[model samples]
Target: MITFQVKDMSCGHCVSVITQAVMAADPQAQVQIDLATHRVSIEPAAADAAALREAIAEAGYTPVPV
Candidate 1:
């Protein structure tokens, strides 16, 4: 599992985008987001941590590994 702190993720839209990006990167990825904490956790089935981070970053958010 990988965890990231996405401080800019504030609403449902942010969560949706992040989830989509992660799924796009690894279809089997399990994504869990805590909007209140701005935290995203992913259990990637194939993608690596770096790839997951890049996917989130490409979605226009800063994902700091936690």
Candidate 2:
């Protein structure tokens, strides 16, 4: 699984947005968001950190490498 730290995720709406973005990037991906840690974990078909980061950014959040 690939993990990203999303600094802008602070609520349920943020979780929804992030989840959508990740799913859009990889339809078959399994995404888990931890609001307490501000972390997003993705088990994608493949590891594409850049794509993931871009997706997160497009969703209006900042993704920090973890």
Candidate 3:
């Protein structure tokens, strides 16, 4: 499981986009978003933080390690 900070996530729409982005990179990944804290937690089948970060970036959000 990897938890990262996405300071711009502030709404349900943002969550949806981020979820979709992560899923695009790793379909089996489990994504959880906490808008209140601006954090996204992902439990991926494999360890690929860089891939995940790139996915988030492609989604239009900045991912910072927690």
Best by TM-score: 1
RMSD of each: 0.4, 1.1, 0.9
Question: Which portions of model 3 miss their true places by more than 4 Å?
Answer: none
lDDT of 2 at 30: 89
Kindly report which residue stretches of model 1 are placed more than 4 angstroms away from their true locations once superposed.
Answer: none
In Å, residue 26's CA in model 2 sits off its true spot by 0.4
* lDDT per residue as tens, model 1, 5-34: 999999999999999999999999999999
Q: Give candidate 2's error at residue 50 in angstroms.
A: 0.9
lDDT of 3 by residue, 1-66 (tens): 899999988899999999999998999999988999999999997649999999999899999989
The lDDT values for all models are 0.98, 0.89, 0.92
The lDDT-based order of candidates, best leading, equals 1, 3, 2
Residue 34 lDDT in model 2? 94
- lDDT by residue for model 2 over 1-66, one digit each (tens)? 789898779999999999999889988888989999999998887638789889999999999978
Range of the 10 consecutive residues with the lowest summed lDDT in candidate 2? 44-53
Query: What lDDT does candidate 3 reach at residue 24?
Result: 89
- Which pairs in model 1 have colliding backbones? none
Error of 2 at 63 (Å): 0.4
Lowest summed lDDT window (length 10), candidate 1? 1-10
